[model samples]
Target chain A: MHMALKFVLLTLLDRERITGYDIVKTFDSAVGYFWSASHQQVYRELSKLTDQGLVNFTSVKQGDKPDKKVYRITRSGKQELQDWLHEPAKESPTKDLLLVKLLNLRADNVDVLLEELDRAIKNAQQRASVYSGIEKTYYSKTQIAALELDDLALFLALRKGITSITSHIDWLHQTSAEIKKRVANNN
Target chain B: MHMALKFVLLTLLDRERITGYDIVKTFDSAVGYFWSASHQQVYRELSKLTDQGLVNFTSVKQGDKPDKKVYRITRSGKQELQDWLHEPAKESPTKDLLLVKLLNLRADNVDVLLEELDRAIKNAQQRASVYSGIEKTYYSKTQIAALELDDLALFLALRKGITSITSHIDWLHQTSAEIKKRVANNN
Candidate 1:
């Protein structure tokens, strides 16, 4: 976790105190589409935040288990988050290995690449449906219209994921057909 | 300069024996849209490939200038590329810092976020136009129709970049409007 994930934790903490375990689960269920952090990374970042005095944890003792550390943002964390929110957005470097493969396309390898394209289209479809499931389970038309500010933010983030995957699948379909046409004509 | 960039370099070398300087230029002009590596990273990876015997270079002496190391793909490099092409494509990890920022949106700080969105839209528009210029410069309708295999692959890659930026701009417009409406209503 770096600058982005640091602020992600602060945003979550600002809303409500949560355990590291809960943060992991929350990310998988809600934020995984937009951002992801592994268990170790999250734990490590949590400690780093504590070291910087940006967050502190309280020990909550359970009946039979070890005491859990429930983390909450400090005042300085809120200030830091506010400053970051005001910073200019840049197009951060992103890698699309599929595009890299396309950049290296060759007739001899076209068949294998086509197979991979088919697999990718299927995978994108699956992801789109899964995101749709989450949208339906958590938000309805009426519910979305009436959501509070925090809920609305979450809803918008979800919408971005759904739209992106839909666009991706559409592009994949067109590209796959074009490649097949080119290869078949050559043969 | 890991598995993906390694293949990228090999792909370039497989096509022609070129200097490291030319490879850097090629990436900026053709491959930067999909994948990027710093100059240092490219040089380092080239050295690594040479050590692994996947790529070999020859020094060309100029009249008064320093010798240039022009590299070509070894037979083993071609084999490595073939193996990679056949392998299943995985969705490599990519981070969109913009999305991370969106995930952290709050009413109090949304004003700044909107400004960032505006900047992002303009930046994307500039990119879209730049890609269009490249497409026009390198490909015409009749020329595209008569293009050979390698040219077609390059054309397709350029088309992908254009389409993606268009979709991104569309989403940014809708999202910015929605965010503005939400913030206004709360105020």
Candidate 2:
């Protein structure tokens, strides 16, 4: 299955009945650590899933708030998710620009490559910091209260992101130092 | 702009001319660490890119070897790569079954989740080991040659992979301990 289908399946798996906002919020809170989907995309996917009979929606009203349309996964949706899991994962092609620039770096303009690498490392670190904060505030609280297994799984994913980012940052530091030494010797 | 396009562009950028085998080898050596592509997919993409004039190929004869068609990127290809760099990165959706199963774990089947987590951590560690080996081999050779700048960048990316994998393994260990504690308290 592609990304959109995965999101729909994940959304239903998280809760029994969730409005579109709830679905977006669920991704924001948990899956957003790794996978990101805008509200427009989520709503569009929800409509498509409903049309395909993979999910069903119920309209409910709050006292003063806007009417909420809650979605539930159908039997077919569960089957689709299972089928997807059984399929061998598609090998995703590498398309990272940082790697592209690194491969292109020659003897001439090494400084530009170094700068790009620094930028990538910093971006990764920023993302890691955000995930760390999310874990401390949300996942940690959930772990203490209900001990929900889902929250625990999400916490683990966040931990993965943090580790990945920290690794990038550390590598950046080492690489930058090495580049500086090379520049000094050359000059 | 897509995975296929990126792979083709990176392959062309690596050298002025390369056959399918050379492209595949490059992927195996470097891109495989961060991105993966199958031989079939690579060949198909090359054909598509050639048709689109993003790349050009010419058959050449080696000493007593089979004639091979080597590919080079066109000016259009460089423009495409630059355009893609300016676009915001699209985050791929996370679809880890091990995490999904863990989220649904009840007291009756906590062992299953534990086993899965154990397996996942093991796999991650194994990957980390491979990446570490590659880094060591690459750095040792490059250090002797005094190609310090390129060596530094390669080492940085390699370290990122190693650290990320180690983090996953650590998180798995901690999560397993937590699960065991919860099981004991419940009993």
Candidate 3:
């Protein structure tokens, strides 16, 4: 198993008792901002964690939906999470495809490049909206003071995401405009 | 072969006829900013590209050192790069381990978290210095106006990188200070 997926699954389970479906939903919404894993990957990791005795699950019969296993972190899981928390993490290298395109762009593809920039701007804006919603829902003023250290850490992570997306959108706009200006000057 | 690495290598070849060692050197220095691959991965890809007739290499006899393979992009390689430039790229999902740590932080690990933040700030500063050197060497005022479209694109990519690192460093400082303030308030 990839160490990242293991740590991420443990992180999610450490939050609250949740079904695999819930993990998938969280990955799609909140946790997905900083870490990405497919639904299948989450389910696979959940099974592995269970087998490893790191997480335990209870089967709940839903009225209409299929029977789901609601997973909770074990004592062992808590110990692992605590150990992982104290361990130093290596910074992941950047692997942005848009940056790759910009580095490799040709003069003939300027229009296509602009289209890509537009797409990126829209994507960043959408992410910004999602992040803002997370902030409002999870880090509201009334909730802020009541937050434990762990919650505060998650809030800080969310804030970092918001900042990152905002900066990215600004850079996209600036780059798009600069390219247009350069093209116009050439003409 | 990973498509991203292939395009990156082709992009490098498009700039100049460079030896394999030069590609490795560039990967360690400039290209490492946005993408990453090990030396073996790069060599494997180069061999695959050569086999596909997209890249060709000539043997160079050095006076003292061992012989080297100087690689040049072929017509097919240029076409592939152009095609790749036009294709739409997905926004690569963020996968930051520090953010992961923040999300999963234990209350007892606050001191370690602060240490990690300090480490990150130092690393970002080091990267910022390297980027500044590159900007000075390649994008000086005279070079900026005289840049060909391709060089201009590389310059724009570099500027985006600088902007990203600056934003990241700012976030680190802000989060660090905020955490400290919160700890004091709680006490």
Best candidate, lDDT-wise? 3
lDDT of 3 by residue, B88-177 (tens): 787767788888777766556768888989999999999898898999987897778778877777787788788889999999999888
> Once model 1 is optimally superposed onto the true structure by TM-score, how far is the C-alpha of residue B152 displaced, in angstroms?
1.6
Candidate with maximal DockQ: 3
- Give the per-residue Cα lDDT of candidate 2 at A2: 47
For residues A1-187, write the lDDT of model 1, one tens digit per residue. 2477888888788889999899999877776777677889899999999999999999999989988999999999989987877878656654577876776677777888889889999999998999899899889887876877667777877787877788888888988998888877876
Query: Which is better, 1 or 3, measured by TM-score?
Result: 1
Question: Which candidate leads in TM-score?
Answer: 1
For model 1, the docking class works out as: medium
- lDDT tens digits, residues B1-187, model 2? 2463454454455456777777678668776665555678778878888898878888898879998988888888766755554444443444444454455455655776676677777777878788878867766754733765555555655665676567667777877888888777777
lDDT of 1 by residue, B23-64 (tens): 888767787787677789889999999999999999999979
Query: Tens-digit lDDT track for model 3 on A91-156?
Result: 777777787788766677889889999988988898899889989876788887678877787788
Evaluate all candidate structures by whole-model CA lDDT and list the values in order.
Answer: 0.82, 0.65, 0.83
Where does candidate 2 stray beyond 4 Å?
A: A1-4, A7-14, A38-54, A61-67, A74-96, A139-146, B1-4, B51-54, B61-67, B74-101, B141-145, B148-152
DockQ scores of all models, one per candidate: 0.59, 0.30, 0.63
Question: True interface contacts reproduced by each model, as a fraction?
Answer: 0.57, 0.27, 0.77
- Cα misplacement distance, residue A20 of candidate 3 (Å): 2.3
